[model samples]
Target: MHPLNDIFVQSAAIFLELATSEFMRYILAAAGLHLLLSTLLKPLVRRRKIRPAWPPKGQVRREILASIRSVLVFSMLSLGAVWAVKAGWTQVYREADAHGWFYFGISVLVLIVGHDTWFYWVHRLLHDKRLYQGWHHLHHRSFNPTPFTAFAFNTGEAFLHGLFTPLLILVLPVSYLALFVFSVHMIVRNTVGHCGVELFPATRGGRPLLGWLTTVTHHDLHHASPGWNYGLYFTFWDRLMKTEHPDYLKHFSAAVRAEPMKRAKPVALSIAIAASVFCAAVLSGSGRAEATETAALETISGRWVTEGYGAVVRLQPCDKAPMELCGRLDWIWDPASGSYLGMEMLSGFRLQGAEWRDGEITIPGKNQVFRSTIKVLDHNTLKVRGCALVVCRKQTWRRLESLPHIGLR
Candidate 1:
């Protein structure tokens, strides 16, 4: 046997061992937390459920399967750290006292804070319209995520997240203990954040320390509305960016209070309750009620002629997701394009304030879709924007009712 071959074989074995160890650690942490919170302690955790509704069937299974792939990607990347350590390339040290007790402790804290900073920026990057479908969509698939959804990342996302440890070790000196603690803390908080349960009580208004850190509700709201709450361990970055959801505190308070049938309030009492709520809102000088009313009243459901009046699309409540809007091609100016009629042109348009967001719109003559948002400009006009990657284009859609001469197209 050749000497080079012997080195290669040994290196491969070490990589495999490291990969297996990392994979099992993830499985144990994710599954153990799921069983503990979602099954064994359901009665308790259910009281602080962030969202009253449960995830749809098969969601958990899908999450776990997708997570397995992510674990492999993570494991493979971790091997790079091991190799770096052997090559004397990274600051990773094994001895506890090598860095002194004080430095050891500080290193652990630094890793936590550094990882948080890394996560905030990387997460925001993943949400770029060009990268979302390829990198972030898998994680967001679990709108009502569970513990199993913690590492359910797309391959691109897994690679980016997995790169953290290797890159960190290369620049920052850390002990093995610090790395272990960081890994454990990261996965635990991640699973809990996705568990769809708020484990912390509401903090006092403007409370210090506790108010600054993120709770389960913070990350869960990110899953519910991806445009906000991009921070991982703390609210500092999101708040600094002015990207934290405005209703975050209100949602946190509601989750902790555990109002029974919160999302399913009886219709009989709705009007009376709504009246009282409206009065309280007005007295408090809050404009949220008016915004809600506007969202509900501005129906974008109707046939509209696309820009250039080249096509007509019918917007309606999606059959598969009744709460969201879907659009289908109703007609096109070109008679030969009849085959495109009845084809879905837009989907997954959820109401967010006065705009419909996080939707996909198909581009003509292409087999792809891009991120889209629609806003009602008036009773007869709509503002439609589509984005592919970093570039965005806008279009104005006029109601089909305004076009009286359809026969002369």
Candidate 2:
């Protein structure tokens, strides 16, 4: 046998011992946490309880029946686990003096993760039409779910569930403790999928810190919309195969939006202040760019500058004046590549009105294009505003007095 098979043969034994040990507490905590989230988020995360193919029942008879089916399936599964043990496999841990608690925990986690990876793919396949009418559809019979609705699948569906772990043990050497942890992880993630409503944060794209952690909301959506949301834990498989529903991201967005912005007010103020200062500087006269006929107001024309180089901006009224106006910006700077990254952004604004206006400014040199608009506050100062995205921002430029007076004729 390969090193991995040997370890799994070993893991099969350890799994039974830990299952009998304090491992139950870890399982309980994971279950409790998911339950708490589901209960709390029910009202906020719920859909309209629209039963499409199936109608609602008074009591959870269907759910109970499903749970019974699941229990039967697992009872059969124990045979596989037990068989490995009877073959003199578990004797290593039973008789061996010991490696202590740390080794034990690691093994349990592997077992659980291996189980999940297996279940995710197999459960996904069992949803096919041929398989569904026979096995998977039994669970779908109760469209509107309750906690007990979990595990309410036909016996055939249960085999698909067991297929993943057995195949997993054949590939790599996973620890027994890790398997248990993974099992607990799978159980909680599993229960939440059938959870009538989702409570945990439904991450879009994935968790920012721990990318790709699935939430109960995704599974709930699947129950609500069969033929979609096949992935049990992560949306990766669903996304890759395009089995995920159309509005999946929308659901995730709502969860992300619900997050309270603790620093929103302060952040807004800081942005506003930075904008105000930059505006004051721009309008105060800095550099001047070449003249363009697009200028809305001839009076707004002048030199806009930063702390260093100056960009000359000129506006000549064009196309019958009052209605149509065009503008242009040219950046004049000491061409030194190193100056760009130096704290004082040596490359933020080069075009005068282009920096502030909500219009397009073309950079023919680099194949880059941008838009900006400017609002003059005084002869010496003005506000320039523009954006690359939906988020708009402002920067100020001061009118430079030191430059030679090159007024429009």
Highest lDDT: give the candidate number.
1
Per-model TM-score, in order, reads 0.61, 0.46
lDDT of 1 at 301: 79
Model 2, span 160-247: residue lDDT tens? 7755554555453444434444654555456555544433432333232223655555676777787687766666777777877787
Q: Count the backbone clashes (under 3 Å) in each candidate.
A: 1, 68
lDDT of all predictions: 0.75, 0.48
CA displacement after TM-score superposition, residue 154 of candidate 2 (Å): 0.4
Stretches of model 2 off by over 4 angstroms after superposition: 1-55, 88-116, 166-176, 202-211, 255-257, 263-409
Superposed by TM-score, candidate 2 places the C-alpha of residue 240 at a distance from the truth, in angstroms, of: 2.3
Pick by TM-score: which candidate is best?
A: 1
- lDDT digits (tens) for residues 110-193 of candidate 1: 999988999999999999999999999999999998878988999999999888888989999988768877877787678667
